[model samples]
Structures are given as structure tokens and as C-alpha cells.
Target: MIDHGLQHPVMVELLKKALVDEALASAPTDRSSTDTRIALQTGLHRKDVRRLREEPVPEGVAAPMVPMAANVVARWISEPRFLKADKTPLPLARTPRLGHPGEPDFPTLVAEVSRDVGARAVLDELLRMGVVSVSAEGMVLLKDTAFVPQEGLGDSFHFLAENVGDHLAAAAFNLSPDRQGPPLLEQSAFSSELSADQAQELQRAARRLWADVLQQFLMSATVAEQRSSSDSGPKQRVRFGVYFHQAISTPSLPAEAAQPARRHKKKPTS
Candidate 1:
């Protein structure tokens, strides 16, 4: 967070408040005694705890939590009407024909996902993120299978927070004594002293594995959505993802240094 410009004091205060809220929600104490319990658990003053609970959430303080752009991208890729014989998203015409019989144009595609948001607005956002591009023939093309905001730092940060936050929550729940069923899947592999070449190969392999896993999950989700439309059953939201990370340790220098220092050659007397 420090690297991301979330400074020490701000992060400390945020974590304190977060802990207070978590304690209130997760503790076995009565609701009326929540402030005291939260204060004790979070090491915050009771008065401050009460104030935090009573105060309204400040506007614009929270990150954007909506995934409307991502939803559109998902539908575009998975919906049969929007895909070609090869199961890839078809290049759409820039303009919309209100009653076209065949595959819908770009504007119609956006409208199908959300009528409140203008197609132009969605197109601009997708273009800015490099998820979509305009073809030479004036058609809009889907450049990526996912709606990842490449150009917007704020959007990227929001994604980071949401994905990591949920993953941690799942892990924490699995660790709790009260956890009921089998724990949500969590596993990792680690090794030290790997050469740079081996690390790169592992990174590439991880990416391929993640891509395959995501494709399977997406297909299952699309099928479930279709089946739910006709079946009378309760629905639930789910998020499935994969991540990879690599950290290299810095080598320590010896007191005498690793190599002898070169002496400067004396310049010829002018």
C-alpha cells in the first residue's frame, strides 16, 4: 500500500476501523455491546468506535465496486448471437440498426447489456482500456476476452482491492473454527533459488493454466445462466479466479565487495 501511495497513518487508521467493523460483525457479543467489543478487539477508544459506527460513510471515499464493464464484456464473449462459428466475438459495425435480424451492431450490443448507459459511453471506455479497437473498415473489434482497464490506474487499483480482498476473506473463513463445509480452494507452490530462465518458464506455464481454468469456468457459468432462465431455482453470485506472483531476493554484498574496484587510469600529462 505504501508503494501505491496509501501512506502509513492513513492505512493504519483504515485498518483500525476495518478491524472494528469486522469484530462487530463476527463477534458473538450482543449488538448493543458491539461498540465496547469492537473497541476491545481493535484497540480503539470506545468513543471513537461509537463515532465510527454512527457516522455516515463518506462520499467518494470508497473505491468503485461495480463490474458493469466486465459484465458487458462477458456477455459479448459468451452470448451465441455475438459470437462467430469459431466461438470468437464477431467484429461489430460501429453503428446500430434498431431492428437488424442477424448479429447486432456495437450500439445494440451495449444496449442489450444496459439501456441506461449509452453505447457510445461504453465504447469509449472499452477503447480507452484497450479492450476494444476500431477496425480499418470502421467496425468495432473486441481486442481482448476480458474487460481489464489497462489505461485507468484507479480502475486497476479497484480490481486489485476487490480480487485480493475477497480471496483473503475466503482464506480467513476457511481458517475459522466455525467453518462448516469443505474450505474454499486455496493452494500454492513455492521454491527458492530458482534461476531467472526457470522463473520465466513457470510464469508462462501459470498463465496458460489460468487461461484454461477461466475458460472452463466461463462456459459453466454461461450454461448455468441459460438453464436458470427456464428453471425455477434460487440463484447465487460467484467469483472464481487465479493469480500468480514471483519475488526475487536481493543478494547481500560482502564487507569487501564481490569484485575488486578498478583504479582510474592516470590521464596523460597535458
Candidate 2:
């Protein structure tokens, strides 16, 4: 927020307005009692509530668009045909090799993901972004597991909002008093007494595990989408993610709080 110029007061005002709006939405039919209910629920002045409701809501900023090249890289790493038996991405030939017309290659991978985008165009963008590299023999190697845009701050910010926003929303819903559905999956593993080496090892292990988990989920989701009927009901969206963070030390109580109270007699009653 300091970097983005979002100061404390601005954030507080945004939160206050959001709280008022949420309270209003939660009980739409209770509008007759809205001003009092919202004031009580959000601790906002009735005048402020009325003013906010009168003001026009600002339209949300759009999420940064991901390029087609990124999609090709994602498919390359996740699709089984493009992966080795060890589940690592296999180096792909830029074009089909002689006498292997049916072989899996870079061009075919791009075509499978999108027909309108040319394979060469996607490959060039990936190469320019340092996400992939080409060898002298025209074999393309995936340099990164994911298509993280290195040049743009907007894409990074968009992803930050998407991932963290959903995570916070899930937790908020789980803790809400009026929650009606089963809680979203929100669990983490912790080990406070870990050396730096152990933490590093765990982080690496988590990445490897995430790759497998992502692949399995994508395959399952693809099958489910193919099998489902669009006319059945409203469509749904889902996101699953994993994260690992290591700090120098685990959180602990402050020194004053951690220490026990000391007893002192009245100086021998002198």
C-alpha cells in the first residue's frame, strides 16, 4: 500500500463504505429498517449511510489480460502428452521431426490450446519473455514452470488481487455468522521448530507436490467440463492454490506477555 499510494485513511474509508454496502446487501428486504441496522452493524453515521447510498458506486478495475503465449506454456507443463514419465515437462521440437508426423511437438501443443493464434507467434513471445528457450537443434525447453510476466507490474497486481482476494473471501465466509453452506477448504500445516535447511527443503517439496496436484485437478476439471451440460444450471468457477512461506522465527508473545509475574514482599514491613 505504501508503494501503491494507498494510505491508511483511504483504506479505512474504503473498508467503511464496503461494510455499509455489505450490510445493505445481506438483508435487502429489510430496507425499511436499513439506516438503523446498517448504522448499528457498521458503526457508521446514519447520515454517512444515506450519503453513500446516494453516491454512485465506482465501476471496478479490469483484471490484466493474460496473453495466449502464457496459455501455451501452462498447457506444455500440465498436459500429460507434453510431459515425461517422471512428470517433468519434455523438451519439444519446434516442428514435427522427419518421419514422425504424429509426434507431439511445440506447434501441436499451441494448436491444441488455441486455433486462431499462430504457433510461431506464441513461441516468439515466450522466447522474448525468457519463459522458454530454443536449442541449436530447434528443440524448445520450458525455462519456467509457470508463465509469470516479468515486465509488467499490472499483471502481478492483478494476480495478487485475484489469489489473495479469493483466499480472504473464503476465510471470511467460513467465519460469517450467517453462513449457510459448508466451509471452503482452508487448512495449512505448520512447524515452528524448523532449521533454515528444513524450511528450504519443505518449500521445494511443496512446489513438487503442487505440480502433481495441479495436473490432476486440471485433468479432472477438463473431463468434468466435457461431461457437464451447460443448460443444467448456472455455471460455477473454482480456484485451488498452494503457498509456502518461511520466516526467521515463528510468531511469539511479546516479552512482557511471555514472562511470568514476579512477587515482592512489603520490604519486611519497614
Candidate 3:
């Protein structure tokens, strides 16, 4: 977290407020005032608790940030009318125009996903992020397989919150002792003694498997959405992801060896 630029003071305050909020939520109906309970549980001064409680909540607190540009890209890539024979997004005309019976141009896609936002504006944003590129013939081509924002820090942070936050929430729900239903799918495998070469091979294998599975899932979801009877019905969105990690550990190190290495003074050179 320090390497990520979240310094100690900022993290400390964030943690304190998070703990206080969780305590207040756990016992909402208790006779004690929320500020009092939060202060007691978090060991923060009552005055500080009051001040923190009154501060305006940060944007994108309760929900994940889904940028309009991302939505446009997802729909463009996933929707059947926007795809070609091989299931890849078709190169669209840079300017708006009527296409073949079912095929849609760039403007049509932008209109479908977000009518208020201009197609040119969305295209510019995508081009800036390297998600789309223009050809010499003035066609906008989808260059990215996913609608991940690659250029903006704010967008990156939002993606981090949406992806990692949901993963953690699922794990926490499964771990709760009082969980009523079957746990959401969460599983992992770990090994302590894999060589670097073996780890790289496993990483490549996992990437291939995940990519295949994700494509199938996206296609199924797109078909389902198209075939749904009620367009206005209540809807729920879900995100599933795959990750890989490999790290070295000094499990066999002696107690002294486990300690931080110290720099020793060099002997005087002759």
C-alpha cells in the first residue's frame, strides 16, 4: 500500500473510519447513540467520531464505477449485430450511416448503449485508452477484448474497487459462520515448491483456460439478454474474474536469517 502511494496517515484515518462505521452497522438498534458506540468500538475520541460522521461520503462508495465508455465498448463487442461471422466485433464506419439489415455502425452502437452521449465523444475516449483504433479507410476497429480503461488513473482506481471489492465480498460472505445459502464459488490451489519455469507454465495455462471460459460466458449472457421477454424487468449484474500469483518464501530460513538483512561497513582497502 505504501508503494501504491497510500501513505500511513491516510491509511490510518481510513481504517479508523471503516472500523467505526462497521461497529455502528453491527448494532444499529442498540440504545446507545451511534457516535458513542463507534467511538467506544474504534477507540476514537467522541468529537472525532462526530466530525467523521458528518463528512460527506466519497463518490462511488456504495457501488462500483461503470463508465459509460466501458458500457459502450462491452455492448459493441458482445452484441450479435455488432459482431462478424467469427464472433469478433466488426470494423464500423467512422461516420454514422445505415448498414446492412442487421449490422450496425459505430453511431448506432453508441445510440443503443447511451443515447445522450455523442458517438464521436465515446470514440475519442476509447481511442485515448487504446481500446479502439481508426484504420486508413476511416473505420473504427475494436482493439481490446475487454472494456478495461487503460489510460486514466481515476478509471483504473474505479476498476480496482469494482473487481477486488466484489472478490473480497464474496470471500467474506462464504467465510461467515451464519451464512445461510450455499457459498458463492470461491476456491484456490497453492504449492510451496514450484520452480520458476513451472510457475510460468502454469500461469500461461491458467490464462488460456480463463480466456476461453470468459468468452463462452459472455456469449451466453449476450444471447440471454437478447432473448429476454421483459426489457424493463429487474436486472442483476455479476462480475467473475480469474487471477494468478507466484512468490518466493524462505520457509527453511533460521530465526536470524528471517530477520531483515543489515548492511555492514566495508573493510579499508589497501
- lDDT at 59 for candidate 1? 51
Q: After aligning candidate 2 to the native by TM-score, how far in Å is the CA of 42 from where it should be? A: 4.1
What root-mean-square deviation over C-alphas does model 2 reach? 4.3
Give the alpha-carbon lDDT of every model: 0.76, 0.78, 0.78
Root-mean-square deviation per candidate: 8.8, 4.3, 7.0
lDDT of 3 at 233: 75
Q: What is the lDDT of residue 175 in candidate 1?
A: 100
Cand. 3 TM to true fold: 0.77
| Number of the predicted model whose lDDT against the real structure is largest | 2
1-270 per-residue lDDT for model 1 (tens digits): 767788988987787778777777777757556777677777899998887787777554223333666777877877778888867788888785533466588887888777888778777777877788997776888886666777777678677877888889889979999889989887788766889899889988987677556656777898887788887667676778777778886777996797799799999998
Residue runs of model 3 more than 4 Å from their true location after superposition: 24-33, 61-66, 97-102, 190-198, 223-235, 248-270
Q: Tens digits of per-residue lDDT for model 2 on 57-172? A: 77444231254775687678777888989877888888886215656888899899878877788887777657788898888988767666565566566667778988998999
Model 2, clash count?
0
Q: Each model's TM-score?
A: 0.78, 0.74, 0.77
- For candidate 3, the lDDT comes to 0.78
Candidate 2 Cα misplacement greater than 4 A, ranges:
13-17, 20-64, 67-71, 93-100, 116-129, 136-138, 229-231, 250-270
| Prediction 2 TM-score vs. true | 0.74
